[model samples]
Target chain A: MPIEQDYSKTENGTQPVESDNQDSNKTPTLPSFTANKSSQTVNTLWRTLITPNSPNVTPNSSYYELISFYVYHGLLVLLYFNIFIFGLITFSINRTKLWFFELAYNPSKSPSVISADISKLNKIPKRISVILNLKPEETENGGISGLISDSSEVCAWVVASGIKYLSIYEYGGELKNNIPELRRSVYKKLAVYYGTDNVPTFSIKVPHANAIYYGASDQDIDQQRYKNTSYKPILQIVLLSNVDGRATIVDLTKVMADLTTTNEISPKDITVKFIDDELKQLVGEEPDLLILFQPYLNLQSYPPWHIRLCEIYWEPDNDAVTYPVYLRALQKFSTCKVNVGK
Target chain B: MPDWMSTFPGYQQILENCTSLFASVVRTGPVPQHIGFIMDGNRRYARINQIEVKEGHNAGFESLARLLQVCYKCGVKSATIFAFSIENYKRNSFEVDWLMELAKMRFGQMIEKGDLCEKYGIKIRTLGDKSLLPRDVVECLEEAERTTANNSKAVLNVCFSYTSRHEITTTIVNILENVKKGLIEPGDITEDMITNNLYTGDQPPLDLLIRSSGVRRISDFLLWQCHQEHCDIEIIDTLWPEFGTMQMCLLLLKWSFNRTYGRKKYRGKKETKKEKEKST
Candidate 1:
């Protein structure tokens, strides 16, 4: 079948349907053939050649049958080939078309919002004991002013970041009994978005006396604070029983020394495998990021886990800064590439 | 020993407990491949020491250098450290200028000596908003990264002015653009696909996340990737300048022990004759 094209309209705007076959007056082009008569085989094969004026039915009916067979088979082969090529072209074009559309629209817009179900998953899966530094003298406000501000900011930040599971360390006095005030403030901000049922706050209390606040706290008393603070049931927290009540680099230096002697491995010889092999067994796999609490930044007293982590320090200075710092740390996870030694 | 370290009688016990915990953990399962650190205590360290704040940062850098060696010694293949964050730019101009100078000098010295990369086969990579940094600092970082790129032994990621949220957004933009270009299928996009498109695509997942300054929070580091329920090792109450390999080992050991124990329990349950009969 021939594809149709509009050719009936004249410059005068008159239109009519016309037949396309108008080649009857023209001579047809034919393939040329040559033959040599020097061979006896050719000479004996035929005495004369038959010629026809046109390909019309004539006396040679047998010749017509052979010609028809070749024509039919040739047309069938051409039709099959055209069909195969067309199918391939269609498939290729469809893929190209889909790609064009996908490129025009951004997929990030289609990102699924974090679901509310995430809150239901926030059961106290892990018992984490936070060491609430109550020494008002040590902490800028004797753990009152700075404590509330810092704790509120920290808790709010964590809650805003979608962390619903935590066992906050509570100082038994006014803070423990009136803890609902802090909880209400945090949850009010949190529950507005996440809903109260999802962001359920949980707390743990430690009995602390004000007499200890007046510089009369013994080492045993301080140690008790430390021991009581670790995430319990599964994890434990031990506070530093010291006058300064700070975990410092000096503490870390000591730990490093002990590790060198006990494991007979120097810090200089550590490897990713050594850390990974151990961590994979414990946590199963690695986390994408790590945040550490810097109470005083005493390297000696820092948590032992900083060894295999990218530590983020969360020490609030007098400036009371937050947000942008957290955002910046979050950005690092994406921009930072593992220096693949090419 | 330093006065602070020497004075602590519990230091030895903590070290012993840490080692045993780590050893036991490792005996159980696999550990992290590449560990990244957000070193966050130069100013506080300085304030405590009553020294110039710059000196505290310089000391922090030294601590990072030592920590790298420790990571290598402990068999960690890659370690990324957050030397500077975008928020640090809010500091006084002079301090920021000094930090840039220190970074340039440190990178220059490392490249010149060829010792850091040559001996340890360390490849240095940087992550952050490069546009915000001084041109010279960016140039030095690029050079450092390029020079160490061929080293195969270990990788060192230096995140300067980095933020995890920006990274995620950037990846989203990239994915969207790629999809538009017909280079990828939109429906085929998944979490792993996003991970592959991230700046740290080549790096492995963070095995253990440790933050310094003894404050408990991720502070917006790796929000998307770390959101998975079971994929984290979070430890609060550590500072960047103060952390060491012993800490790394302890975390690793704990991770390993958990895996090994879980696997053992699983195998024991699977191989029980009664269980097999019940299944039949």
Candidate 2:
């Protein structure tokens, strides 16, 4: 809800005195001489501070008139001071408007001339590294819908350029406050994806200590959804052994449906068998050369896997990552590092 | 007047009366220094022609050569075209393999013919992540760049596995590491410091960026350097192969005219006229 509008005091100057019954018999009282006694203290201090070697004036003159003259002169000075400040403010606003117009018309002009004096863009390399928490248990946000965007093409460029060393931040880290365990889990997943050995060289810790909030509960989807939410829910899997390393992810929804044969709960579920086959097809027979994980997800929420995996039980932030950024991060990661699996 | 001029409306009369006026406009325009092209839509073009994706790429390669000639004639000192991106390698294996072969074969021929250096005095330079490319393709690119290094006519930058974000970040990382190593002072790092560290260190800012195949987005081609000064343009219904000298001429003419005839003065007179009318 937006806040209610309130501008009665500013827009209109009417005092509400007669409306209330308590104030009907009360007469407005003028400020008394007692109030002026404390104000005279300020006057005495000013005179003491400025009256050193002061020119002698007629002592018989009215002190009230003298103080009134001084007050009027002070007020006059303040009026002129305010006028000067207003003029400066108007000039500044006009100058800024002119500059903004210039920037829009000639965007190619070097921004340094008009921009504030700041350090070189080189000094601070603000890097954004994206990691897709593909594990189904990780979906607190609405499936993969928030993870993919049109920037996949840019991600391709990043990979081709051989840019490694990215800042891996958990998406929506600020919403939940600071979850150290989640951060650790995020890095662990990266280590697994890039291989544990390459983790030290390829990724940097997300220095921001923050929490992302979760809005959905695990039971929001299907009551039995918890059973299949432990492992990574893959989208497309790619394997790159020759030429330029390019891989695609395998589809999961159909595979899972194909795995379920008996509509009853059983140890030998067809879904696990399907997952194995799909993983094999995507990663190939190579031991350390390929891997699979869904890039963009939607519909189903990713379950909290770290809590289940370690059995410590920690709640996952539902709003931790958006789909578009997740997709972009995967693209950027693939572009930067040559995932040499071990 | 040429036969094509007769087909036009006002141009027909202008051709008869004022011939030098057209030449004068051309001479006075500020010719672009470097013109870059983001070649798109080979697959679409291939589909339209009932051809394979490889065939579309081959057609694109041919279009590139013709475009280069037009760029040279326009007095453009440098021209860079995005031939292949790193992510493009992730497509179907057969298609990706064909593209690698195509780059090697086409670039190798251009190098062997000495056409780039001997005929046009142009120097060939390859940009982007060369390491990600096949060994054979890398070798072909290196030979081409080395052979044409001494040429002074023009610089042809073939952006193969390039991403502007990676390039900028790489430069920044290098600068950061250099500072940490005590090899350079932090204060010494300027805008030029970052620019000089980039792959195209010796080149100037792009004047015009033309994406063929009618795509509006640049797709992270040249990120940090290109926001303000460059024009990102798209041509409608034209594949890279079909884009000829005429297309390049039209684009360059429009760009040069804009640059030369750009305005800087404020529109105070119009405001004053409006105010006078409002008062009445």
Best by DockQ: 1
Cα lDDT of model 2 by residue, B79-101, tens digit? 88877776676687888788889
The list of candidate 1 runs beyond 4 A from truth reads A1-342, B1-29, B236-238, B262-280
Query: What CA RMSD would candidate 2 show?
Result: 28.8
Chain A vs. true chain A, TM-score per candidate?
0.29, 0.18
Write down the lDDT of every candidate, Cα atoms only: 0.48, 0.46
- lDDT, candidate 2, at A166: 27
lDDT measured at residue A39 in model 1 versus the true structure, 0 to 100: 75
TM-score per candidate? 0.42, 0.41
Model 2: per-residue lDDT, tens digit, A1-342? 001013333222333442354355445584333444677768766666543221221232234434533453454334345545764686577556545544443312122321211121122112222333322222343222222211122122222223322222123322123233333433344344335554321111222212121112223232243245452221111212111001111122222222222223221332323433543344322121111122111101111110011101011112233222223233333333221110
What would you estimate as the lDDT of candidate 2? Answer: 0.46
Say which docking band candidate 2 falls in. Answer: incorrect
Top of the candidates by lDDT: 1
lDDT of 2 at B231: 42
TM-score of 1: 0.42
Tens-place lDDT per residue, model 1, A210-237, is: 1111111223232344345442221111
